[model samples]
Every structure is written in structure tokens, then in C-alpha cells.
Target chain A: MTGQEPPKNPHGDDGPNPPDTGMGMTAVAYLLSGMLVWGGIGWLVDHWVGTRGIFAGLGAVLGMAGGVYLIVRRLGA
Target chain B: MAVQSMVLADVPFPPSVEDFYLPSILPWGEHDNYWFTKITALVWLSAALIIIFFLVAYRKPQLVPSKRQWLAESLYGFVRNNIAIEMIGPAGVRFAPYLTTLFTFILLNNFWGIVPLIQISPNSHIAFPAFLAVISYVMFIWVGIRHHGFVKYFKNSLIPPAPWFILPLLIPIEFFSNFLVRPFSLAVRLFANMFAGHMLLLVFTLGGFAMLNANAWFLPFSIVSWAMTIALTFLEFLVICLQAYVFTVLTASYVQGALADEH
Candidate 1:
């Protein structure tokens, strides 16, 4: 052992991608919550507007896009 | 099939969720009583055991080592080094005590799921995990607010680095994901695992009896079912440890997220 002070948090490790950072769960959470929140909101909008499932479908797709965007922004960069 | 009906006469073929709601202890089957139960007893026992064990283990001071002291130290070191500091950075040292306590409490509680007669985890109930999750949730938020102040902390987490045009879309997503999902998932993940583990064991153990009770021809299959139950117990052991470790690591990760500067 070098007897030096241990490296700091996961980022301090030598590996390019540290493991078990809990970011994976965070990513999944973003994706799922994104779809649920926007889609549910769209469904309510549809209910009020008296439209069919079109808005809900659009919302799910848009939310999923936002989720990917968030993952890329937060975890990727 | 010639068999003594009284041996396992009341063995319900397919175990149900009712089995988990063990009868009350305080009132002794008086019905409409929920003050004390086996689950409550196990939880209290686990807490007391940890408190006493740690107190006694570190009570004696030795430079070289004693077995109990060494064991206690190892547990603390693992959580501090591997979980707290590893996940939360240098500032995590302050949280090692809480993380270690959490790890041991969950480990012991989950262990009860497969322990011979004490075959039910207090965590199988949603209330216990929900409360634990609340503590973690409140802690990270408090830490974040204390570190960055209330407004800045909310800005730090709720507002992502994105083009201003799309911020309206992104901010809601961030709030829902970070604030709402984190605690809900934390509680559900642990409770479901323990609950399902108990249910799985109950099914196999009772399936054996159910098969034997059905007909003599199924006796061999019943033996195999019991054998599978034994193997699954070992698997349960692995799950118990993994779930405990996962919970601690995630809580530390949340704290780290709270303390992060930019990214």
C-alpha cells in the first residue's frame, strides 16, 4: 500500500467509467417518470379537450424524447 | 392414500397474502388489534441486537485486536470505505455511521426471511421500507439544502443544463424524476423483494405438503419440492445481502448527488 490518502468519490477512480454509481437507476427513473408524467398530463388534456388518444400518444413520444435528452445531458456529459 | 390427516391437517395448499399479516402478540388473537405482532418484535429485536453488539464490541479498546472488535471494525470500515466515501466522496465520512447502521439493520431484517422459524422479514411489510425511504429522502434533501441553500439546491436539481426554449419541458421531467420517483422506488424495491421472497418460500414449502396430501403417487415430487425449497433458501441468502447493500449504496449515491457541484 502506498499509504497515501485514498482517492475521493467514484470520479476519483482511474477507470474511465466507474461502476455502481446509481446513475443507472437515475437514468431509468428519468425515462419512466418522463413518459408517465407527460403522458398522464396529455391524457388529462385530451379528457378536457374531448379528443381521442392522439394527445396521449404524442405526449408519450415527446416525454420519451425528453427522457433521452435528460439522460444524455445529466449522465452522459 | 392412507395418511394421518392430523399431521398437517391445516396445511393450506396455496398460501395467500393473509399469511404475512401474522396475528397480534399483545392481545393474543383478540382480533382488531395491531399494536404488537411478530413483525414488530423482530424489528425491535434486530435494533437491540445491533445496539448491544456494537456497544460491546467497541467497549474494549485494544491496539492489536479482539475478534469482536475486529468484526465490528470491519463492518464499519466496509460501509465507510466502500459505500459512504466511495459513493459520496470525502464528505461521506460524516455519514458512515448512519450508512453502517442502515446496512446492518436491513441485513438482519432481510436475513429473518429465511431463518428457520423466524421466516419473515419485517421489511416484507411496506410500512417499514416506506419509513426508511422517508428518512433517506429527507436526509438527502436536507443535506442538499444545507449545502447549497434552499433556492440554489432546488435550482441545482430541478433545472438541468438545457436550451432555454425547452426548459419548460425539461424542468417538470426533472422534478418528477428526482423528487417523486426516488423515494417511491427505494421503498417499493426493498419491500417487494422481501415480500416476494417470503411468498416464494411459502409456496414451495406448502406445495410439498399439498402434493403429499393430494395423493401417494406425488410423494416423490413432494420430496423434490422440499429439496428445491432448501436450494431456494440459499438463493434467498444471496438476495438478502444484495438488497441490503443496494439500499445503502443508493442512499449514499443520493447524498453524493446532493453534494455535487455542477454535474
Candidate 2:
């Protein structure tokens, strides 16, 4: 049997009106923001820990987690 | 350059851990390139296999299908009905095919990492996951901007409805989290999990082999380690499927967010 599809909530309430924009702008924003944070995480880890690999890894994870939280809260709200 | 020279050139390129990674069937110079080289080949092979199998199985569509056809159909319907349409809504149904392909590709690639002979997953490589992440990132951004204008998409992404005073602190963080964090997290999550799982398997399996070199008494302990490796292999299989599902589901969710009016 095929998997069941979930019913959509028609009464869903979105918070506000979003601005209209082109795909390229958003894509560039996502890409550049991620790379910058990645670099920042690396720098922060190297400065604090004096060890690069593991701390950088943790920084990346934290940065990502922080990102996901913000996006979900923003969009979902 | 001749194939022989190229192969020979790689032979002396470096002598390290890679030299130890002799695949059960050396596809000539096939496995010589990079961490994700085998991954890419296997991913392509898996795609080809899936396509061929489906074509052959459903050559003449039937109400009561053969086993192969049933398996293929089940896989298709599972992703189509469960993930794509479910997350994205009826309007999103058209995306089922692409989403289904994506799910299966990631699933096969992730699972391939733990398979006996082909012991690497391309998704475990940062590049492949990064590529997928970028694709997803582009897609969602496209969809979001198409639904909302570019300016609106940006606002929806970061600027939650807030008092003017709150903008000073919240805007940059929101912007960074939404735009920068999404794809990076996506890539790292899959990469880290797969990489760590693989490293663990290597440790257990190799440790067992290394331990066996000890006196006969220590040889028995190696069996326990091997057993753990086997158990972890099963766990890895579960992880492969789970991670693939998570990635696909998240992608669907993001796409849905793009298509829908921002909340």
C-alpha cells in the first residue's frame, strides 16, 4: 500500500505579508551567509581553543543549530 | 594522456591510508581518485539500476504486479505519498517525482557506505552533501522568492513581525541563522553522521584485525569486536535510511515554506 498523505490545515494562519523578491537574491544570501558563519566559527574556535579541528567542528554544529532554530521560529511564526 | 600513464601516475601519487583501501573488486583505476569518487560511481550506478529495474518491471503495467514491479512501486509511492505531497500539499504533488528520485538517491548512497564491498557513501563526503545542500538551498529560495517577491522572501526569512526597537539585535541574528545556517547545517549534519559512523566501523573492524595479531589468547577478544562491528553495521543501515528520509523531508518542508505565503 502507498503511504498515506497528511491533510493540510486550511485554517493555517501566516503571521504577516512577505516581500516579493527574485530567486537569485535569496540564493546568494543563503550561500554567502553560510560561508561567512563557517569562517567565523573557524576563527572563533582557533582563537579560543588553540586547537582547530574539533572545536571548529563544534562551532559549525552550533552555528547550524542556531541557524535552524532561527529559520524555523521565523517561518513557523 | 593514455589511461596507463594516468593510472601509473596515481600509483605513485602518495602512499598512505588510501593504499590500504583496496576494494574487493578494483575497477582498474576507478577507486583511485578521491574520498567521494567511489561514492559518485555508486550513486550513478544505483540511479541507473533503479531506472532499469523500474523500466523492466513495469514494462507492461499490470493491476497485479510482479515482485520487482511491486518493490519499485512501493518505493515510489512511499516517497511520493508520504513525503512530497504530505509536506508540500496537493499543489505540491507535481514535485513527487523529483523528490522521490532525490530520496532514493540519497538513500542508496547513504546505505552504500555500510555495504560490505562498497564501504563508502558519497553523502559522507563534504562535497557531495554540500552540493545537495546547495541545490536544496537554491530550490527553496527560488520557490520562496517566486511566491513572495525577493524583498518579501528576505523579510520572511529573517524579519519576524516585531517592534522597531527589537530590529537592532534580532535582525542580524535572524538573517544569519536563516540564510547562512540552513545549508551549512544540512551539509554538516549528514557529513558528520556518516563520517563518524564510518570511522567507528573502521575502528572496530581494524581494531579487531589488529588485536588478532596478539597471542592466541587475545585472538578470541577480536571476535567480540567483530561482533560489535556487525551490530554497528545494522545500525548504520538504519541510519542510512533515516538520514535520507530526514534530508528529503526537510527539503520538502523548506520547499513548502517557499511555496506557501510566509507566516
Candidate 3:
């Protein structure tokens, strides 16, 4: 749209690093899925233990941490 | 949504979601019959138009390129070079055809949402976008599998460069995000855009009618509503092109990711 080229580099076989279309999606997915998956697992654990959502809360925090780690490792430059 | 046209020749007030469904064309007044409807017809029509136009336009390849050929060539060239190649690089040349078809199909279908008489997009239906997402999902996974062996592809996508203790946390997140979320988000994004755009237009257009019918004093407000509908139609046009471009570029990006040898 800028009528100019996106910069390219010689890294992979494709030469051009993928543009910014789905990157936002992948970032969001990783963040949300990390929390939801861990949080849901913790919810199940809570159901089994009959505790009052404490485990779920802990899991959400842990999952959020995992999400941030994944985002940095995978998406961070 | 074919079942939404509960009664013919009568428009509903407030334009509930029921307005999305139009009466079946194949079996006239039968409420349950959804064999063929405006949505179905529009989809088929768009497909046919694209195929026929490309074929006719390029029936005779020319050195100078006729207007039809030029238009057809530019469309293909734009997607091939801009979207496919730009996103996926040189190897993306092989993928230009599919990307072009996807762009045109979605663009046409989304364009229908703003068309005067036919103000509904087939893409407003989740099934269409979901199906397209399925195709992209399958193709990317298949490409990944082929490029990297099945075991390796899974390793590449699911196992990021991380320490072993953190592996448990990271792997599940990777699988859930890459495998599960990609297709779901792809389908939902396009469907939601078209669905919301159509709903917005419907509210503006039908709200004018509902208002005018309720009170003559509401004429000016009704006129303003109609004006808003026109303005929103232009906004819908922008959304239509954007959603189409987004879908194609994302698909190409997925392919690029799938084919990447390293992070």
C-alpha cells in the first residue's frame, strides 16, 4: 500500500520475513490460550478437590506467566 | 439464514436477526425448505462470475494485452506479487492461483453486503468462512508435514526453543494456539466482520422505516438514519476489502510459517 517494498533479508529459504498480518493473531492466541488452558485445567482440579476456586486463580496466574514467556520466546525479536 | 424470511412482502420492525434469513427461492412459501436462497444464489453466482470472467478475459493471450486481459492480469499480478509472494517470498509464486481465487471469492462475497438490493453477504454466515478456514488449515498443516516430516513438523510447531522444565507449559500453549486457535480465529474474524457490518446496515436502514411508521414527527430523524445507512455502506465497503485482504494474507502467512525451516 505504500507503493514500496517490504524489506527482505537472507535468513530462511523464503527470504522475506512474513509481514504483520497474522502475527497479532498468533500473539493473542498464545496469550489467551495459555491462560484459558491452564485456568480450565485448574478449574477441573478445583472441582476434584472441592476447593473454592483458589487453584483456578493460581492456575490463571501461572498460565499468564507461561503466555508471556511463550510470547517473548516465539514472538519477541 | 434462509428461514429468516418468515412472511413475504412484509418487512419486520426493529429488524431482528430473523431479517437475515430470506425466503427460499426453490420452494416458494415453505418455511422449512432451505434448498436454495438468496445467500446460496449469491455465493454460486460469485464463483461462476470469477471463473467465467478469468477464462474469457484470458481466452486469447496478447502481447499488448486488451482491457479485459489487462484487468485480469492485474488482479492476478497483485495477489501473486503483493500478497502471496510478499508474505511467502519467491516460492509463493506457486501459491498465487489459490490466493487469487480466495481473494476474489471473499472480496466478491463481502462486496455483496454493500450492494443496494442485495445487502447481505454469504460470508455473514459462519459456514462459508469456516469452510474456507478449514481449507487453509488443512493446506498449511499438510504443507508443514510435507516440508518437515510429520514428527519434525510437530516438533517445530509445538516445541519452541525453551528449557526442558518449561517445556510442559510451553508445548500446550503452542499446540493450543497454533493448531486450535488459528483456524477458529480465521473463520470467526471474517464471519464476525461481515455479520456485524450487515447488522449495522440493517439497523440503520430498517430503523428508518420503523421510525417513519411509528411517528410522522420522526421524518427528519428517519432521513438522518437513511443518510447514516449510506455512510455506513461506504464503511462496509472498506471493511469488505479489508477482511478479504486480511483472510488471504493470513492464509499466506500461515503457509509461510509452515514452510519456515527455522524460527
Candidate 4:
């Protein structure tokens, strides 16, 4: 995110280029996880409530919050 | 009296899908259906067009490079250096071929959705997106387990270090979300957007036609519907490109994650 970019990592003895995403893989991973959380909750809620609209509305709010929380926690660590 | 009054009735312009439905084009015979019925032909045609453009533009492959060569090189360079290297690191160079092929394929198929007459996107078909997602799903999972043993990879994905109490809740969520939900969401996101977008366009475009043919009074509303249909067409182009990029970016990210240290 900074204007200053880090030098690229050197290749490992095993082959070439280490397995890091520079920003770390967590950014992308968290986004995917967030989507999954929203989708899963929506699906489950729809099944239980027998209403698609209510399921999506509530599910999105809860899913996004959970997703952000998990991502921040991971990043902080 | 009923017939005259019915003509003026507010039949909220019929949906767009009916106007552009396959029915209109279906009667055109084998030549017409060739582009629409088979998905791969559209993809192949798109890819062929790209290849021809590049080849024609850069036949000399000059060191200084002409404008066309520059454009071609820039595309290859952007995908190669920016997306692939950024996602998979320098080691990703080895996989550049696969990544390039994917980016080109998806980008072309997506563009098909807005290509005027040949307006259907191959990715709109659930089967195609599902196939791509499955490949990515298998690729990452296979790489993860192959590099680290199966038990270790599964443990790595599920049991990232956390407070002991939190682990209980996180484990099930992480396992299901990553293993079960990842592929499904990946497929559905692209599928749902294209499906819905195409349906909307169909409703507006087709409904307008159906209404227009019905009566003179119906023409004005049909015209408004057609305008909206055209706007949605433009929006659809953006969605197609964005979805393709998202799919590829997410794939690269997943692959990167598999290669990273598990925590």
C-alpha cells in the first residue's frame, strides 16, 4: 500500500522465487472468505426461514462483519 | 369499447428477455445457430481474433517495436509481470503460459457477451464457469497437499493459530467455507451475474419488440424499454470484463496461498 516498494525476494535453493504474495496472501484469502461467509449464511438462512429476501439481507450484514473481523485478526497476528 | 380501452391499458412494458429470446434467431437455420449453440466456437473465434491481431501487428517483432507491437507486448507484459508475478512471485514465470492462456480465454469469452449480434457469453453457462472453478479448486488443493502432506495441508488450512476458545468456532467455519464453499461461490458469482444480466437484457429487448408489434400506442413505452435495454448492454460489457478479472485474480491468489507458509 505504501509508495515505497520492497525489493523482490530471491529464489530458494529448491527452485526459484519464494512463495509469498508481497502483501502476503491474506488480502486475497480474506476477500474470498468474506464472500463465502455471506453466501453460506444466506443459503442457510433461506433454508430455515423459507424466505429468500430476508435471508440475503441479514446474511450479508453478518457475513461481512465476520469476514472483516477474521481478516483483521489474521493480519494483526 | 373494451378493445379500444385495452389498447391504452398500462401493461407495464413486458420484460426484456422475451424480445431477445432465442426464438427470434432460432428460425435462421444452421449457419446462424453455429455461433450461438456451441460455446467453444465463440471462445475459439475470440482467441483466433486476438492471435491474428497480435500476429499481424507484430510480424517483425522489432526491438524498438511499432505501435501495434507495443500494444501486443504491453498486454502480454501487463498480464505476465503485473498479475502473474505479483500473485505467484518470480517463480510464477514457469506458469506464465497457463496464466496467459487463461486470461486471454476468459477475457475473450467475456467480451462475447457484448459483441453485438453474437451477444451470448460462454461463461454465462453454469457449466463453463463451474469447469474453470473446478480446475482452480483442484489446482490449489492439489498443490497444497502435494507440497505438504494431505493431513498437514488440511491442518494448515483449518487450524491457523488462534485463541483456544476461538479455535472451536473457527475450525468448522474455516473447513466448510474453504473446502466446500470456495468452488461453489467462485462458480456462482460469475454464473449468477451473467445469467441475471442476460435475462434483464432479454426482458427489455424482447418485451419491447413484442409490445411494438401489438399496437401503435404501445410503441412509446417499447422505445423507452429499448433505451434501457441498450444501457444494460453497456453495463453488461463492464460486468463481463470485471468478472473475468476477478476469477483469474482469485485463482492466482489461491495458488499463491497454497504455496505460502501455513499458519
Candidate 5:
């Protein structure tokens, strides 16, 4: 913690390296898991309530949005 | 055209998934025991090779390093300095041995795909990557729990620094992302890459042979296919190294994230 400075962008721009943030695959994973988990829950609720597939679709959209937001927050930090 | 069609019928051009499902060398029942496959053998071989390599390479220490010792040291240094240190800061030193082992183990197995006799990487099977991913996932969780108490780690991970009202929404998203997604993607990425690369090599090599037997007119095209196969072999060599490095770096980053006081 004391010895090394935080990583800087190799291009000399004020950005973190893609690998440093662990964005590339982890981001994709987050997005996918979000959709699957939330959407699955939604589907179960839909089945119970006998509503059409609407809630599942809504859940997927919400999940995607939440996933992206989470990625932004983590990477930006 | 008739001659071409006739010759083409004699040669199998495209290899299918069946081509990859090679028979086990031992007379073990194939479908009965999932572990009794050629891929399993390769996995054992890779593990043995890694153990033997380091043992032989570092048996003697000298003031001036020998070639074997130098190679071993450089590889260790690369992962220690570049990946673990860069990702985890000063605290990275303790994690270097684990990261180095992960890097070299993966690198050697992935490289076995291009080796003359061993044309298939064990990692082309999903099980190998999934196994590695599970180990990594467990390690990061253990590290996080050790650093901050188990309850605190879960609280920090799931409940992001957000409004109280948003906790319900954020908790599920964060939990799924951190726990479910991380290991799943790690396994899929490695498996998919190796699987596709091996399939592509199979196609080009087999296609060349098929084309050569198809017709005299197709002989030149066969040469082209073979040349492409050779070129892709070199590309796969680069990919093998890159994938190993990428896997090691990501694992280190996860460890770093776990150890961080602040998200």
C-alpha cells in the first residue's frame, strides 16, 4: 500500500487501464447475472400472479440498467 | 464437376464435435466415468509437468543463474511484478506464488494444444476452466472474509455506498454480479476460446486434406487452406499466452478488490 502509486493509464491520459479496472469480462458477467437472477425472479412472480410475460421482460430491462449502473459506480470509483 | 463431387465424397472435409470426443487410452468405460477421458489425462500430465519443471529447474542455485533457473525466475518475476504487484499494490507480495502457479499452469496446458502430438488443450473442456474459476472464487471470498469479518464483507459487498432506499435494489444486483457472474464468466471465457480455436484448426487442417483429394483443380486451394492453418497456429500461440496472462491478472484483481478497504 505504501510502496506503489495507483496505476496510471499507459497512454498518459487520465484513465485507468482496462485490465486494472477488471472491466472487460467482469462487466459482461455482471450484466448477464443481473438479467438472469432478476428476470428469473420476475418470471416466478408472473407465474404465480398469472399475468402475461410482461413482468419478466420488465425485470430484464431493470436488471440490465442496474448492472450498467453498478459497473459505472465501481469503475468510476 | 462430377469428378470433383466424386472425390469430395471420399474425403471428410469438416470435423465435428465427435472428432473432439477422442477415446480414452485406458479401457475405462467412457460414459460411465466422466473423469476417464483423454482430457483428464492431459490435465494430470500438465500438473505433473509443472511440478517436475520447477523441481528440476531450481534444484541447484548459483551466483550466476543457469538457463533453467533463469527461465523459471523470469516467469515468476513477470507475474509477481507485472500482474500481482501492479494490481494489488505492496500487499501483492504474499499472493505472488499463487498467481505465478496459476499463470504457468494455464500457459502450459493451453500451449499443449499446438504441440505436435497433443493437438488438443485440456482447457478446451469446460470442466478445467470451471474448476479453476471455482478455486479462484473461493480464494477471493476467503480473503475478503479474512480481511473484514464475514458479516462485514457481505455487507460491504452487497450494500454499496448508496441511499438506504436503494438497498433493496442494489443488494440483489451486487450479490449476483459478485458471486454468480464472476465464476461463470471466468469458466466460459476460457472454455469458449480454447474450444473455438481447436475447432478452427481442425476445420482448416481437415479441409485442406479434403480439398487435396477432391480434384486436381482443387490442389492449389488445398495449399491455401494448409497455409491458413499454419498462420492460425501462430495466432493460436499468441492467444494461448494472452489468455493465461489475462486469467492470472483478473484473478489478482479480484483478490485486490477483496483486500481493499474501500470499494
Candidate 6:
């Protein structure tokens, strides 16, 4: 993924460039929010179910996955 | 003589975080309040300087720009062309004034850290950045709501076009990322940068002073400490300007996201 070439413009047309400078920061914001929101929910569920911290861990993993998905959908487009 | 007194002093020579906690200038009285603090005064001073600068620069319209007019125009042009237009497309023209004001205000206040007497950035206090972030937050939300009606905007924001079953999981993530994270990160970034930068300057400067009080054999090393202080000051100058630019650009990006048609 690190070495991948810039993808060719599928439209084969040169147009105004999309703003890419702030994309990395935006991606980070999305990732952090994802973890916090879902992880909080999971912690609450774990408390209710009388489990240890397992649900919070699971929520963080799922949140990260969701965050990546959102980043890909927004920036990849 | 001052160096001799400092050397003979029976206490620590270096400064501490308490040095940043300046006492309020005004004595407690009928008119005095917590709001009338040094940082508050500096904030007002920065605002006044920005207003006076442009007023003096553009008092006379010039077919061929004067030096002051050229400088003012260039600052405005940079924000308008590079940040506003680059981030939000043609529609960003309307936001040029606000972004330009924010950039200059932040840039001047950050630069205050290096000034001789006023040696701290107001933004080192989180309250300042938090206030600015809240303004940006309101602005983007207002823009989104205006562009898309109230119901449509929230619907588009929280409910990304995903399969129905997945939305239960996705909605929380989307809502958090959009509403909560945006402003929190914005405020923290500026506050942390300014706070760390000022603290670093304090460490080096105080270290140099402390070294000056060492024995005659060790006194020469103070030169090295002072040299490092000077070098760090130059680096801090770049950080001061760069942080201002970053804050403005991120703001424009958030505004762009809100105005975007897609989720």
C-alpha cells in the first residue's frame, strides 16, 4: 500500500485538482471519533452485562474498522 | 552586579510553570473581575492592532498600491486565494473576510510569545483556542443547515448511504466523527502547540540564566545555552506562523465538508 502508484484518472481528463492537504488530518479526526464513540458504548454494554473489559476492546476494534471504511469512502472517492 | 546577585542567591535559578501565571495588573475593586486578566488584555490588543493596521493601510484608495496597501492586500489575497478558494472552491469567496481575520489574529497573538515583555502566546491558554473552535463549529453547522434543510443535513450526516442493518453501528461513528471530534481536535491542536512551544522557550531561557550563576569555571557554558535559546526562538517563529496557517486551512476544510453535497 505504501509503494502503490498514484492511480490513473479513470475519466482520462485533467480537471481542477482535489484538495489533498487536509485529508490526513481529517482522516485522523474520523479515526479518533470512531474509537471514542463506539468504545464508550461498548464499555457501557460491558458494565450492564457484568463482563470485564472485553466488550470495550471489541468495540475499539470495530470502531477502527468503521473509521477506516469511512476514510476510504470519503477520500477514495 | 546583577549576575553576581543572581549567582550568590541561595535558591534555584531556573524558572518554573509559575512564571507563566502572571498576576492580574488591575487591583481588585468595583470594576475589577477575573475577566480583566493579562491574556484578556493581550487578546483585545491583538484585535485592536489588526483593526488599526488595515484602517491605516487602506485609508486612501490607490490605483497603484502603496507599500502598506500592498502588504495588506497580499495578506488578504493569500487567505482568499490559497486557503478559501483552494479548500471550498468558488463558493469560498464569501468566507474570505472571516478566514483572513482569523489568520491574522492568530498569527499576531502567536508571535506575541517572542516579544520581550509579553512573552507568551494567548493561545497557550486553552480558553482562547476553545473559543475560536466553537466559532468555527457554529459556522460550519450553520453553513450545512443553510445549504441543506435541517432534517436533510442531519439525515445526510448521520445516516450514510449504507445497508440498513449496518447503520445501527455506523450512525454513532459518523455522528461522533462529524460533530464531536471536529471541534475538539481543532481546539486541542492549537492549544497544545502554543503551550508546548512557550514551555520550551521558557526551559531554554531559564537554563541559560541558571548556567550563568554556576562557578566561574562553568560560566562559559552559559553561552552555549543562550545560543540554543536563540536558535529555538527562530524555530518558534516558524511554528507561530505555521500554526496560524494550519488552523485557518483546517477551518476552511471543515467548512468545505459541511457544504459538500455528499455525506
RMSD of each: 2.6, 9.3, 4.3, 7.8, 4.8, 6.1
* Model 6 lDDT per residue over B1-263, tens place: 88667555644445665655667667643233455667778999999999999999889958688888888988988888777777777777789899999999999999998887778989999999999999999999999899988988888777777678777877888888888888888899899988988888777766666665565565568677778878888898999999999999989888887777754
DockQ, cand. 6: 0.20
Cα lDDT of model 2 by residue, A7-72, tens digit: 444122232322321223334444445445654667787888787576666655555544444444
Q: CA lDDT of A2 in candidate 6?
A: 11
Task: Encode model 3's per-residue lDDT on B55-74: one tens digit a residue.
Answer: 99989988888899888888
At residue B103, candidate 4 shows an lDDT of: 73
* lDDT per residue as tens, model 6, A1-77: 11222233311112332656588887887788778888888999999998998999999988888888878766666
iRMS per model, in Å, is: 4.1, 7.5, 4.3, 7.6, 6.7, 10.0
State residue B13's C-alpha deviation in candidate 4, in Å: 9.5
List, residue by residue over B77-108, the lDDT tens digit for candidate 4. Answer: 76666666667776656655666667777778
Give residue A11's lDDT in candidate 1 (0 to 100).
Answer: 57
How do these models rank on TM-score, best leading? 1, 3, 6, 5, 2, 4
Q: Compared with the true structure, what per-residue lDDT tens digits does model 1 show for residues B36-141?
A: 9999999999999999999998898588668888888889888988887778766788998999999999999999999998999999999999999999999999
In model 6 chain B, which range of ten residues has the least summed lDDT?
A: B27-36
TM-scores for chain B, listed for all candidates: 0.97, 0.84, 0.95, 0.78, 0.92, 0.91
Q: Candidates 4 and 5: which is better by lDDT?
A: 5
For all candidates in order, the CA lDDT equals 0.88, 0.67, 0.86, 0.68, 0.80, 0.80
Q: Is candidate 4 or candidate 6 better by TM-score?
A: 6
Better of 2 and 4 by lDDT: 4
Query: Please, what are the lDDT tens digits per residue for candidate 5 over residues B193-246?
Result: 898999999899879878667666888898899899889999999989988988
Q: Model 3 segments beyond 4 Å from truth?
A: A1-21, B1-11
lDDT per residue, candidate 3, A1-77, as tens digits?
Answer: 12324335413453546547477777888889989989988999999999989989998888889999988887787
The CA-based lDDT of model 2 is what?
0.67
